[model samples]
Target: MHDSKNALSVQKLIADLAGIVRIMDQKDQQLAPAINAPSQSWLETWMTAFWETLCREWASIDQWRMNKVLLLVRFFIREQFGLALEWAVKQDPKLKDQVARQLRVLEAWPLSPRERRVPDGLRLHVLDVWTEELAGQLSAAQKALDEDAENSDPESKKSILLSLAQEFMEPVRKISREAISKGVKIRAKEAVKLAEEQLSG
Candidate 1:
């Protein structure tokens, strides 16, 4: 178990990381129109360098002894890092397929014996949404989820179904206030009902 001091240090590091991501996002929004390709190219270069350095450092760590850090990093991969990757893909549509594959790889990282448990309901949902967001199509994520559902054991099936509920609970709520397509909204609601019935049984 992590001592409080180590836990605090991790929290501080995560906060700093969060700040960096937000700054990058804000700059992207502010300068995207004026500088266009050059700005995006520069940002992509920086992001690539940062990711490579991070991967190297990650490899050098003794993650088994750092369970708390490992769990936080896995959650970061599922959420913030995935969002950053999705943003990168948005800035370059050609990279969509590549980033999607990488995101899936990161998503699966948490399931390694190092983590000792499946991703919980909320993280599963966030990962699925990022997949959809990156693809600019919910159908892609839904299809993948359906395939997983088909292949999973009954216990894993519950996690898959819970993700469906999460899809509706969060994104659907925001989409409701936006001018989203009717078909997408209907599909999301249906997913929620499907999750409810299956999980209830």
Candidate 2:
């Protein structure tokens, strides 16, 4: 999407190009097989069409809309893929690990219009790995924390848990600070220092 001066439907044009991008990226595995070897499988074609739509929509949306788009993408992946998700995640633990990395990028929350070039292509790369898969990992982490809590003294637990929470929370605090306009960055200075101290300690 662009300013008023831009001609034609930028949304449609972007979507069209993004459809091609999605197909091209998946050509080797998902798209090529259907084209080269003519599968009568309704399932395969349906899946491809779904992916095409997702990619096209993702490319053409603003940041706020993009959040909704990603949620829909996750929901569709889970719904379209049921028991298969377990097999997929089981087969590729590394892919599950990558989702956290992708989520971190999303959480940083790019400022739309300005940071328009954010590559959600990476998100698509690992989309087959579902939220349950990622959430399960987080649950596992928290479970470990719970187990640790039983063993740790109150002071030790406070230190460890506070340390962990600080680790997770500091990035967002940093971003919220950074999100302030250029003139307001000075205000972020103390928050930035706090994050550094928390991180370093």
Candidate 3:
């Protein structure tokens, strides 16, 4: 038996499972093959356990597992497979609220399911409503870079922020490419550049 304390590290597993589950949840249903794939049996076993764990967690109606919930939202929006998400939501009515609106946005405007197989670093062609959230995160990172007056010098702090920003910029690039193809305006072109500098400098 798995250790009670370490049996699954359900919390960590939830976070790690984010990438795999998003493929299962995306409405693209065709992408199911990508996420459903695993070289190891442990993956299938873990996901099945996660499914059951989701039920256990649902009984308590807790939001502590929200990271996994967010990942599930990604799967529903981007993955080709819809069954895993549908099954999960059907199993737990509570999961509906966290992901339903996002799923609606995806269904409202979807791109090629095959594109989902591309790494998130390369495949995020466009973000629907989620851009606002991404912007907020980048903005917060910028503010931290600008406002660390109390803790560190601006240049040093900026170096940290720049590194953070650069890491974020790659996704922005993909989003911009995707959005441009779809004819949506980008909100943070400058922020993307700033992050690039951070990443390189």
Candidate 4:
């Protein structure tokens, strides 16, 4: 009976994650054209009014993307990992100690400070790194989860998930915020550069 319950829980979690991924895919499709649109011509770019409008549009799109990613992270933490950890603790009180230890390790992990300066022209690269890091972590977690499900030990599987959650939750949020902020700064700098070029020309 216990094994059956664990199996069902794992299946449900995987299904939920799959559904979220599908939604994200749809959003990506919707956003891709706008994000990948060609840059404005030099003449249009020189107009201060047009430049300001472009900056706003780009910032809005970037913020929307960041918000979606953050929402997914929050959903994973609250709906999936949080509930699973709570269930595990209720099932085996001894597991709480292990969770605590894992959390301590996570807490000790060095997080890049939120206010760290992002170099000019490197914003997109930094954002890519942040996005890749989160994607890599999620992919690794999913793989580990599949491996854990194959094992006969339900407690061990829950422990592993809990550890993964502890390691990722805060870092994901931090990186998302940093990425969004850097994107905004990049847009501002771009606007200024456009104005400068216009004046120089």
Task: Output the number of the lDDT-best candidate.
Answer: 1
Query: Which pairs clash inside model 2?
Result: none
Q: What does candidate 2's lDDT look like per residue over 61-115, in tens digits?
A: 6754554455545544433322222223233443333233333443433211123
lDDT of 4 by residue, 1-201 (tens): 224332324446546755654453345335545755422322212222322333344444454345443443344333323333433434444334333433333222212323233232233332233333333444444455556645566546546554544444454344434434655445434433433332210
TM-score of each: 0.36, 0.28, 0.27, 0.25
* Each candidate structure's count of clashing pairs: 0, 0, 16, 0
> What are the C-alpha RMSDs, in order, of all predicted structures?
16.0, 13.9, 16.7, 21.2
For residue 11, give model 4's deviation from the true position in Å.
36
TM for candidate 3 is: 0.27
lDDT of candidates 1 onward, in order: 0.42, 0.40, 0.40, 0.39
Residues forming the 10-long window of minimal summed lDDT in candidate 1: 110-119
Q: Is candidate 1 or candidate 3 better by lDDT?
A: 1
Q: On a 0 to 1 TM-score scale, where does candidate 4 land against the true structure?
A: 0.25
Q: lDDT by residue for model 1 over 14-126, one digit each (tens)?
A: 67766765665566556656863532533344445554444445535554434544544544444443344334423355344334434344333321212223333322333
Candidate ranking (TM-score, best to worst): 1, 2, 3, 4
Global lDDT for candidate 4?
A: 0.39
